[model samples]
Target: MIFIIDSLNLREHEPLVKDMFRLRKRVFADRLGWDVRVSQGMERDRFDDLDPAHVISVDDEGRVVGCMRLLQTTGPHMLSDVFGAILDGEPPLRSATCWEATRFCVDTEVLTGGRASNSISYVTSEVMIGAFEFAMSAGVTDAVAVIDPVMDRVLKRSGNAPHGYLGTPKPMGKVTALAALMDCSEERVARIRAFSGIDHDVMQPHRVTA
Candidate 1:
């Protein structure tokens, strides 16, 4: 399927953003029992209001399948401001061009399976490309994602391998992040597209007889 990347400002995206948050609460707070503070039936935080944050994701027939949050570095991200305590009380971020990518999640029920499923797991391609486009247009050069180890594998395969950025994986205790910078190479961009296609090809089976 041809997945389009839609980036909307809060005023323009209130509805979709609302849906995204509801899905987040359903998955992160309600389903996974994360102790996220609730407000107006949506989970929110202080950082949510700051940094002219950008929301990028795949719109699958009006449902948000994959999503990621990008916070431009006007102020310190969790890595610089919050994660330090766990990472020896020191910030790992090294560039003002960095934008933090967070809340990267895929709707599990709609996710593909085995090889076919693995194919579409690259859904983040469009989202990342969209985010990267936004950054490049805004004259940005660096990016970061604070993520879990498993999720880190996805980033690594996508060519965002994080070895020369700022730090290495550590015993983060409760701390977590994909935590890597953006690499704007033609090959990297191509990989993002290739994988996104593998992840989001429109063709699907015509029947389900179960």
Candidate 2:
């Protein structure tokens, strides 16, 4: 299942959040070799302190397997603060209707099966659906994500391709990073749900407060 956790109720879900950070450390810092900060085996950055909503995918055993972070573009975000190079001199997109999605990572070690609910592909799709739906509920029309080439390709293959791009791809750590613009619409969500055969709702009952 998917859980939307933010600063409002982070203290109540401390263990789940810690596991998510550890999973990020294993994926970004350890596996992908991204130049991310890892202290005490947990990957984190300044944006994490900005009260961004975290979309987390948990297994039947209640272990966090996949996750992503969402921040309002009207405020400080990675594309505006950390990854300005990808903009190519163009100003970063800042608006209340456009949010930034980042820190997307899945625990591949535990989800090593096929495209079932317990597999990586299923969890990835679930997380994407959860993020988009959560954003849509908050009156957001668009979402900008700083993704790598591999993730871009994955998005395309999964029927969640970006509608546009901000700028050209730039070399970042072991991969190339680019800003992708995606619309939070029902059609897009339906396509993803059909592709993953996930017809049911992916989100939990809790709502995230801005």
Per-residue lDDT tens digits for candidate 2, residues 1-210, read 898999888998899999999999998888878889999999999999988899999899999999999999989999988889999978899899999999887898998757788877789889999988888888898999988888898789889999999979998878888899999889999999998899987877665633
For model 1, the stretches where C-alpha displacement exceeds 4 angstroms are 1-8, 30-35, 92-94, 114-120, 163-178, 198-210
Q: Which stretches of candidate 2 lie over 4 Å from their true place?
A: 207-210
Q: Could you tell me the lDDT of residue 37 within candidate 1?
A: 69
Per-residue CA lDDT of model 1 for 165-197, tens digit only, reads 445555443434335666544456567767555
Flag clash pairs in model 2. none
- What local distance difference test score does each model get? 0.56, 0.89
Q: In angstroms, give how far residue 37 of model 1 lies from its true place.
A: 2.0
TM-scores for all candidates?
Answer: 0.73, 0.95
Report the CA-based lDDT of candidate 1 relative to the real structure. 0.56
Least accurate 10 contiguous residues by lDDT in model 1: 201-210
